[model samples]
Target: MMIKELEKLFVRDLEKLRGELDQYPNEETLWKVVDGISNSGGNLVMHLCGNLQHFIGAVLHDTGYVRQRDFEFNGRMDLNQLNEEIGKTIEVIRSYFKDADSETFDGDYPLEVFGYPMSIGYFLIHLQGHLNYHLGQINYHRRILS
Candidate 1:
């Protein structure tokens, strides 16, 4: 089914992000920001992870999720912890999708997130794209920091 495919893609992309992030020798370097507009490589990791939580809470549950948008912006985390967080986020997403049906992905399941209407399929695609974009940033940061 489409949900199964999306779940596979999601896991694949997460693995790719993890592999790319693992290339950074020094974890602290992942926290170095190049410009004011861009976040550090590590920040991107946290950003994506936090967004996962938001999506799972908002789209999946409709409520009961508290997102610390500010906390994700503050401080540096150990690479191990960062990886653990990322893994946790991925697990949450996977679990969410496992129970999803075609109707859920086909717009039959409608939800208002941040006051915007979203389809589960659209949200999943958006999350995958978002992760890929940040993965690119992390890769670039690694190259520049090296």
Candidate 2:
């Protein structure tokens, strides 16, 4: 039940991010940083994708995925490629959640993201919140930039 809820939120936010990307008027707009913004919507999406792939894919499933944290912000990708990557991230997230069970959720997280020992379930919630926080940023970026 907990996994189900987490999966729902993950998939939903990923899809929402994808949809928001599509709503951007152009690739340039997706990459534009507003005057006061530190990162563009494109950078936020890339960061989110790299983050999940690292924590959930490589760390949890041993998928051998490597995260380039710096490139996630500095990189430039066309909107089509960005959407394709988001699709891959969504698949990875779904695969992990589907295989996870109560014991898995109760197990220790592979890394101490919050500087303390925490359960996988707790970290998953934190990840989801992180995703949503950026999703909101992307939405506002699009609204203002478009």
lDDT of every predicted structure (CA atoms): 0.76, 0.91
Q: What are the models' TM-scores?
A: 0.85, 0.97
Worst 10 residues of 1 by lDDT: 106-115
Give the best candidate by lDDT. 2
lDDT of 1: 0.76
For model 2, residues 99-146, the per-residue Cα lDDT tens digits are 899999988997898799999988889899999999999999999998
Off by over 4 Å in 1: 61-65, 108-115
Tens-digit lDDT track for model 1 on 11-130?
887787788778887777778877644688877887888887787655575545577777777866888888887787778877788677888776733546547876777777877888
TM-score of model 2 relative to the true fold? 0.97
**Clash statistics: count for each candidate:** 0, 0
If candidate 1 were superposed on the true structure by all CA atoms, what would the RMSD be?
2.4
Number of the top TM-score candidate: 2
Please identify model 2 stretches exceeding 4 Å from their true place.
Answer: none
lDDT of 2 at 23: 94
